[model samples]
Target: MPKSKRNRPVTLSKTRKKGREHKEAIVNSIKQALEDYSSAYVFTFENMRNLKLKEFREQLKSSSRFFLGSNKVMQVSLGRSVADEAKPGIHKLSKFLRGDAGLFFTNLEKEEVQRLFEEFEEHDFARTGCMATEKVELKEGPLEQFSHEMEPFLRKQGLPVRLNKGVIELVSDYVVCEEGQPLSPESARTLRLLGIKMATFRLQLVCRWSPDDFEAYREGLDLSDVESS
Candidate 1:
C-alpha cells in the first residue's frame, strides 16, 4: 500500500474583512447630493452652531442640500483627479478642502446662493480655548453690567471683585482675555456674564462647480460689503 500522503498544514486566507459599509453609504449620499442639484459649491465655516445649521437646512429644504462630513470621503465622491471627476473640472474643488469645509448642493440661482450665504451670520459667546478676536479688559471700577447678587459668582469665576454697598465692583483692571491668546475658562465665564460675544459664526463660499464651468465664485470680495451693497 502506498504510504498515506502527509496531511498539508492548514493555512488561513489573508483576506481582509469588508466592514466599511458606512463609508460607502457616505460616498453614495454625496453622489446623490451631487446629482440631485443643478450645481455644487464648496464652503468653509467658522464657529459653527448645530442648531443654526439645522435651521439653515430647514430654510433651504425645498431647494437644496448641505453636506458636512469627512473631507477625504467628499473628495473621493467628487473624484480625486480629472479623469474621474464627478463633473467637468469638479476635481478643482477637492483642492480647496483645507479647513472646516462642506459641500452645498442647490438648485437656486447662483446669485441667490451667494446672497444667502452673505446674509447668514450667527453670533455666540466665545468658548474656552477659543482665540480672542480682541482684548477683553474690565476697567477698575464698579461692574454695572452684573448685579449685586452675582458678585459671589463673579468672585468665584476668578474676577477680583467684591460687593461694595450693593454693587459688584472690580478691585482693579483685569485682563479677561488678550488678542491672539486662547480664552481662559475664567475669562470665558466672565465675558459671558458681562454680555460679551466674541465668536462670530459665518459660512463662506469657497468655490462653485457646474457641468459647464468651475471657478472660485467670490474671491477677494468682502462678504460684509457684498451683503451691504
Candidate 2:
C-alpha cells in the first residue's frame, strides 16, 4: 500500500459558531414572514449611497415589523408556495441587490401600505425608488364596480385623462402624486379629476390575504377605538 497525505479537519471557533447562530436566527425570521404578514412589498433603491442606505435602515427600524436578508437565504427559508410565487420577482431583485434589497412585511391593509409608501415617496431618498413588484390584483369590472363615489373626488385632484387607444390616459405629465413632491402637468390634471386627497405614486399593493380578511381587519376596532372597561 502506498502512503497517502491526509488533510486535517476544519475547526469552527466561537466567533464562527456565533455567526452561524445569527444566520439561523435570520433564517427563522424569514420563515415567519408570511404568517400574519398578509401584505408584503418588495422595493429597491437607486443611487443609494452608503450613508443614505444606513439612514434608510434606521428609518425602517422605527416602525415596521419585518426582516431583510440575502435573497437566496430568504427564498430558501420562505414557504414553498411563497418561494415559488416570488421566484421570478426575486430574480428581478437580484440585480438591485448590489445596492440595498429589503422586504416590507406587515399585516396592515394593502391600502394602508400603499398610503405609507406614498407618504414616504419623497422622503429625500425614496423619490427615485419605484414599486418593484406587488401581489395585489385590481379586479376589472364596470367603472362603477370598483368604486365610483371617488370619481368626482379624484377628478378634483388635478389628474386629467384622455381616451388614448381605448384606454384612459392622463393628459398631463406624470405627477409625484404625493406630498413634498412636484407633479407633472398631465398627472396634476388627472389627479385633480380623480379627487385624490393624497398622492398615489408608483406604490403598488403587492400580495395580501384574501379581500375578506383584509376588510375584516380594516373594519375591526383597534386599540384607539376601545374604551376602558
Candidate 3:
C-alpha cells in the first residue's frame, strides 16, 4: 500500500496575516452593490443589538444591502480619493467610516430611505456597565407583579424582598438603579426580570452619495476632518 501523506507537520508560525483574498472578495462585493444600487449612504449606530439589526435587515433585504465590517476593507472598497474611487463621489463616505459606522447600498428612492432610517429604533433591556436611563424603584408593599417564588432571586438582586403568605413583598423602598449611574450586573438582571427596557438601539444617517450628487446630513464630519486625517 502506498504511504498516505495525511499526517503532515503544520508550521507553528507566530506571524501570519489574513484578508488578502478576503479583502478582494469584499471589494468585489461592494463594487457589485454599487453597480446594482443607485445610492449609497454612510450610517453610524448606537447601542447595537444583533437580533434587532437582523430584524431590520430582513425588513429591507429586498431593496437594500447593508455592509458592516472592517473600516479598512470598506474604505478600500469605496476608494480613498477621486482618482481611485470605485464610484464617483463615494470617497466622501469613506471619511465618516472612522467610527461605529457601516455602508448601506440601496435601490429604494432617497425619500423612502431617509424616512426608514429616521424612524428606525429598537428598545432593549440595559446591560451591566450601561448607564441607567431612569431611576427604577420598588415601594414597600406586595409585589403582585412577581410570584412568591421570585423572592430569593429578588433578594439576591440586592432588593429588600421577602415572601409572606405565598406573595412576594418588598419589605422597604429600594432603588434597583439610579439615573446617570452605570447599572450593576444584579441590577441589569433585575431590570430585565421587571420588564424594563432602558437601552435604545438607533442608527443615524451621516451622508448620502450618488452618481450625480453628494450630501452630508450630519455635522462633525466634513472635508476638514478628511484633510486633517
Candidate 4:
C-alpha cells in the first residue's frame, strides 16, 4: 500500500556541456592545419610567457600556425588509432601528445625551424611557486634601486628597511630568496623590485612530420638525421 513515486529530473555537469563546443573548434582548427601545411610538429613548453609566445607567433604569422589545447582532442583530430588516422601514418604522432603540448604547422624547412626555436628566448620576472635559480642576499645599506617613497611598500613585503636622506636603506641584511626553494609572493616582489629576472621563456621542437617522412627533433639536430618507418 505505498504511494507512487514522482519522476526526478537530472542536471548535466557544467564541464561536459561547456567543453563540447570548445573541443569541436579545436578539432576543426587542427584538422585544417594538418591539411594546409606541408610540415607539422609536436611541441611542449615550460613556464610559458604569454607575451613572448605572442611575439613568437607574430614572427611566424605569415608562414606558420600554432595550436595549444587538450591533448585528447588533438589526438582525436590526428586519429587515435591506425585504422582512423587522419593521414597515412599520423596515428604515430598521437602517442607524443602529452603534457603542455601543442601542434605547430608550417612550410619552413627543417633546418630553419630548428634554428628559430633555438634562438627564440625571453627572460622575465619569476612568479610565486617558481623555484629560485639562485640565492639572493641584500646587503644592509642604502638600496639605490628604490626611492624613499617605496620604503613602506618594501616593509610590507617583509623587508626591514627605512628612508634616509630621500633614499631607501635596509636596516639589516635580508635573505630575499633561497636557491631551489619555491618563490613566495614577498620574495617575487622583492626580486622584481631589485631587477632580478629568473625566468626564461623558450620553445622546444619535439618532433616533426613531412608527407614523405617523420622524425624526432632536438637541439642541434643534424641535417643528416632522420627517424621514421
Candidate 5:
C-alpha cells in the first residue's frame, strides 16, 4: 500500500529488437516455398479486405501459399543480393516487394495462375476519405426504402429528410455524394445505409520468377533501393 510501480523506469530495447523470431519464421517459410513450388510471383494489392483474402487463401490452399507482410523481412527471405539469395536469379523479384505487396508461390499451370489473379477482385463499402466511384443523388420525394424512424438520423447526416405518412421523405433534392471526390464521414455512412459499394479491392502482378526464367509485368518497381542495399 506504499507506492505504485506503474511509473517505474523500463528499457525500450525489446520493442526495437522484437519480432526477430517472427522474421526468421517468415524467412524459413519463404525458403521452403522456394523448394515446394515451381514458380513465384510478386503482386500488389489495393484496399485490402482480410476476410475476403482469407476466403481466397482457403480456396487456393491446396495448390498455393500466400505471404502478405513485412516487405523488408520478405526481401531478406528471398535474398536482396545475389550473394545472399536463397535461390539463383530470385533476388531480383524482391525489388517489386515495395509497397502493399506480397508473394505468391504455386505450382499451378501458369495459365490457371494468370486467370486466377486477373479475375480476382472484391467490392467493398467506401470508408471516409475513399473516392466516390459514381455520383449519388436523391430526388425530392418519399424515400420508401427507409422507415419513418430513420428520418431523424437522415436529417442529422445533412439530408433534407422528414417523416411523411410513416415513411422517410426527402423534402428537397440532395446530392449525397459526388463522383471523383473523397467521401466524407457522413457521406460514407450514408452510402453504407444505401447499400452502395465503391471501393474496388484488386491485385496486380508485378513480376514473376522461375528456375529457368523471369518475367517483369509492370515497370519501375523501386529497383534503386535493392540495388544500393
Candidate 6:
C-alpha cells in the first residue's frame, strides 16, 4: 500500500497577530476620542517635518488641545453619523486625509478654537515650505460676486478697499473676536467684507474665549454671532 500523503496546517504568525492587535487598539482609541471630544477639526499637514511638527504640537498642548489619529480610525471609532455631524458641511475634508491626518480635539472656549485655527492659518502662511492643500480656497470671482453684499459691512467697519491688481484688500487691521463678544462696528464690517464665513463644524467657533469669560464659562457657544452679537 502506498503511504498516504499529508499537508501541514498553517498557523497564524505572532507578528501578524501583533499588527492586527495594534491596529485594533488604534481604532479603539479613535473611538474613545470621538466619544470624549465635544468638537474636533480635521487637518492635514503638508511638508511638515520634525521640528515644525513638534512646534505645532507644543502650541496645541499649551492651549489644552490635542490631535487624534487618522480619519479611518476616527471614522471607525465615531461611526458615520457622529462623524458627519461633528464636521457638518465640510465633507470635503474626508477626501484629504491621505496625508498626515489629524483631528484637533478641544473643550476650550470657542474663541480659543477659532484663534487656534487662525493661528494655524497664519503659521501655514508664514512657513515657506508648508502649504495648505485642504483649505477653503477663495477665488477672485466669489469676492467680486459678493463685493456688493460685502461693501456695506466693509464700509461700516471703516475699512477701505484698495484695488490691488483688480482685487480688493482690507485697508485696516482687525482683531479676533470670540462668540457673544462685541466686535468694533468697523471690525465687524471688515470681517464681513473679507468674506469670512461660518465654520462648517458646529463645534468650531470663529473666535477664542476671552480670559474674562474663562472665569465663569460653563459651555461653548456659536462663534458666528461674534460680529452681530
Question: lDDT: which is higher, 1 or 3?
Answer: 3
The TM-score obtained by model 3 is: 0.84
Q: Which pairs clash in the backbone of model 5?
A: none
Q: lDDT tens digits, residues 10-76, model 5?
A: 8766565556787898899999999999999999999899998899899999999999999999999
TM-score, per-candidate, Cα-based? 0.82, 0.35, 0.84, 0.84, 0.85, 0.37
| Native RMSD of candidate 5 (Å) | 4.6
What lDDT is obtained when candidate 1 is compared to the true structure? 0.85
The residue ranges of model 6 lying beyond 4 angstroms of the native Cα positions read 1-18, 62-65, 68-70, 81-100, 121-229
lDDT by residue (tens digit), candidate 2, 1-229: 7555575566666353346677778767754655545555555444334554455457665445544566656545542232353332222222222224456666666666666655643222222323312221112322332244444444455434334344444455534344444544534443334344332223322323332332112233242311110
Stretches of model 5 off by over 4 angstroms after superposition: 1-18, 219-229
What's the TM for model 5? Answer: 0.85
- Lowest lDDT 10-mer window, candidate 5? 220-229
lDDT per model, in order?
A: 0.85, 0.43, 0.89, 0.86, 0.89, 0.44
Clashing pairs in 3: none
For model 4, how does the per-residue alpha-carbon lDDT over 1-229 read when each residue is reduced to its tens digit?
Answer: 7654665556665464546888898888888988888988988887898888888999898999998878999999989766788887676677778898888999999899999988988889999999999999999999998878898999999999988888989999999999999999999998998899998877888888888887877566443422332
Q: Kindly report which residue stretches of model 4 are placed more than 4 angstroms away from their true locations once superposed.
A: 1-18, 218-229
Count of clashing pairs, candidate 2: 31
By lDDT: ranked, best first: 3, 5, 4, 1, 6, 2
Q: Model 6 over residues 69-185: C-alpha lDDT tens digits?
A: 556655554344424533332332333334466656566656666665555522222122222223332333223544455555544545454545555555554343444444444
Full-model lDDT, candidate 5: 0.89
Report the number of backbone clashes for model 1. Answer: 0
Best candidate (score: TM-score): 5
Per-residue lDDT tens digits for candidate 1, residues 47-120, read 98999999999999999999887898889988877788777677777777766999999999999999999999
The C-alpha RMSD of each candidate to the native structure, in angstroms, is 11.6, 20.3, 6.6, 6.7, 4.6, 19.4
CA lDDT, candidate 2, residue 101: 49
